[model samples]
Target: MSVVTNDEVRRELVEFLDQRQPDVVREWSLLRTFAEQRTVDAVGGCTELLNSLRRAARDGQEQNPAAAGFDDVRPMLRASAGGGASRRLDLLSLKEPLLRLWWEHRAGTPAVTDGALALSSAVDALRMVQLEEELTAGTETISMQRQQLTELSTPVIKLWDGVLAVPLIGTLDSTRSQSATESLLEQVVVQQAKVAILDITGVPTVDTMVAQHLLKTTMAARLMGVECVLSGIRPQIAQTMVQLGIDLGDLVTKASLADALSYALQKTGLAVVSADQG
Candidate 1:
């Protein structure tokens, strides 16, 4: 019997796929492994995928499969058809047809066995790429969402003609503090306000770090030509500040947002009294 090498088997498998492209595509499209029913062009995507597999089969090895093959086609795999992070299940559906090709030659010539191994390696490499893409995309989305939440949580609202207010409602972390300060300063300059209020009624706790963030925000507002009124300093929080020797250092403060708003209205020469007062 003539000895057949691994390379010969791989070449034959590649040729088989090349010759049967249409049939393979049709068969792959009908597999039940696909979980996501996408609107992708099935024929075109399957054709491109097969083309990658052929290149992979030509250059890839069963020992180390993730090195090449699909590297050049990463953009299409990441953004189109079944290659996106969201369509990983759909990508998994592709493995069924490739596995069947291996089954077809499992009991045939030794060359067929070698070809099947190469085909299996190429498919495994694509799986690795898909996992990496999904992880990267998931991390990026989380980072973007955190940034948006930080900005949206510290909304600066106009309370009066010359007054703006920032109502803080969560932990005073460094990121949120910086977001608050930047927002408050910008609005102070844009609204040309004389008074700004930092209301912390919803703040759950007070610590040295929280005190420092509050002071920094007030100082920044001062530089923008707006006086800051710290409000909603609950009794427990005030006691903690004193216990910790945290100083207000001549910064104006009030017991509640209502008191702070009253101070703001007076500073802006506006009065809100009941009609019964007259």
Candidate 2:
């Protein structure tokens, strides 16, 4: 195969693009309708890509020009990913008009053929870069969502002036357990509460591991000068804990939230008296 000089390739590409300017404009106009909500202006993007291709041919090195063009297009590609547009289809659609023009201007010439191959290689490089950008964007989105879920799963609610309660729901894995403990301890310091309640009414079962998690949380709260109360112990859970020989040591336990709250209020030197009693 014969190699074509950079100058020859640049000349052929320039001529092809100049002759097909109107057709390229029409293609972009049509594509703009599909990308209306996207930040990437289709017509401007097409022009930029063409200019990059021209520079690559002119310099005989595709990386610099191609990379710059891809950088310009990266944000647009990320926007498209969020908006349900197919990146591969967009690339193919953009390439069609230019490829058609190239084929028509210098179909049978060996030098122009090599030039066409180089142009195709540049387009493929742009695609690879776009894919990488999309992957990074996706990973970032997942990390944010995970953080939000953690916050939601371990909500610390203020029950009174000097009491905070954390209601645990669903499974109690090591990760969730740790998060709940940290959140409770932080709220203890922030609210200056003397009492912290861990309610497990929504918990379906109690096992050795679950008991251990509760013990650890109680120990942590004690270290912060706050007493911890465990509530929502159903009959089944109590039976399970007893059968499993899970000793909760000195931790206070209550059968219900109301009982726990009543105890907390008493510890804080506040009493709820009925009008009839008075």
Candidate 3:
């Protein structure tokens, strides 16, 4: 795509009008001849000329998809195709000059303004197409980004083959809670995990919502035939839980990830052996 800068377009227009005076003068003479010679059929001639120009513009856009401002040419040509024979001839007269200016980006050409205008129109058309493409792509982009954010924030880990670790970090709102439930359930099925660990060492605070979310994730994992062990309760959090009357009577709780792992191994019949004794 050739980019026509504002300065370059201005200079070309100046020089074109200076040197191409005669060519333009000649086109005007032809228009006059057509108007006088066939004033009655001038409209027909103008229609034919406009049709030819329209076809040429279409062909140009097709041939060079990347050509700057190619799309705008057709609409402009259409807009100029109104009224009597003389007006139509005037419109037709613009075709050759514009095409010439486009093909040869040189100075001393009188039709520089037409060329510049066409280029501007083409740019506008291309922008519309580009905007549509971006909007379409945004949906996919948001989904992928949300997944990445989940993966980064959630401390869910897959220990070896059938064992998993999910460390909860930061605040778990309703959305995060829902996501955590979904993720744990999917991973259990996909990994066929026998044991899953829920570690909350990095959590700064705990509330009813977060507690509820954790409970949901645990239950969902169990439903998938996976055992879930909650770990990493700070002393302060434990006190807060007690004060808030939160009950984990049914849920398995461990002091840390290591303790949870040991428990999970035993539950899954994965015994820890001493290598030195062997």
Candidate 4:
């Protein structure tokens, strides 16, 4: 009734051959012997299958000419892809049935024509649904890849008290730095935290441009009434920052996450729970 149903039948045929039934076992044995004994051409099986289908159609031609026409066309329709020529063939596959329905209508069988039209419409609708599912899956895969890239490139961590520790783990070229700036700002506003500690310890080096971007981000945080701290500066990085003449005097810089946490806690008017306090 449908291409899907026909595909299922093909699968069932393959499965039937695999089950090794007494009748099919003889056929399988012959095929195995043929493959073992002779130097068969690569496409011999395809050619034989096509020839057999052609002979079957020819044998049925005298019995039912219309059904033979449909059988003759089934192969071409099955071989068609969703390409231009295949689209034409798919429509042509149903054309013969529609033509028969037209003749039947003239013979006072309008119900036959109605049934054929409904089946044809149903097949076309099913094709559209399959195409839509393929497109949606492709779109979702791309979206997931983008999400994974975002997670890998940007680092986010939560610290004690209300502070969030975000470490810039690699080089912050202008594009990545911009994304980081926006993502950090959004998280800070959403969390409503008083402190955001950006630890750059994992950053191997710093350039003037990256330092400027950091300055801009820290300034933006101040405008939003949130304190932003730079932490985890190795000696080499500190030297680079100073040599590059990048002024971070307006912002607080800490030697480590612990120091940054202490500074943030003091600024936020909060104290860490010591053992005695507990």
Q: Write down the worst ten-residue block by lDDT for model 1.
A: 32-41
CA displacement after TM-score superposition, residue 252 of candidate 3 (Å):
0.9
Candidate 3 lDDT over residue span 1-278, tens digit each: 55665555545544544455455444434565355645445444444433333333333442233444333343333333332334332333444554464446554455456455644443344434334434444555778898788767764568757889877788877777777777777788888899998888988888777788888888888788888888999899999998998877588989898888888888887867799976
State the lDDT of candidate 1 residue by residue for 96-197, as single tens digits: 677675566345666666666666667777767766756666687789999999999999999888899999998989999999999988887789999999
- What ordering of candidates by TM-score runs from best to worst? 1, 2, 3, 4
Task: For candidate 2, give the lDDT.
Answer: 0.76
- Ranked by lDDT, the better of candidates 1 and 3 is 1
Q: Please list the Cα RMSD from the true structure of every candidate, rounded to 1 decimal place.
A: 3.3, 4.0, 16.6, 15.8
User: For each candidate, what TM-score against the reference?
Assistant: 0.84, 0.78, 0.52, 0.48
lDDT of 4 at 21: 30
The lDDT, on a scale of 0 to 1, for candidate 3 is: 0.62
**Using TM-score as the measure, which candidate wins?**
1
> On residues 147-231, what C-alpha lDDT tens digit does candidate 2 reach at each position?
7887788899999999899999988878778999989988888999999999999899989998888889889899999998999
User: For residues 118-139, what per-residue lDDT tens digits would candidate 4 score against the true structure?
Assistant: 3344334433433444455557
lDDT of 2 at 187: 86
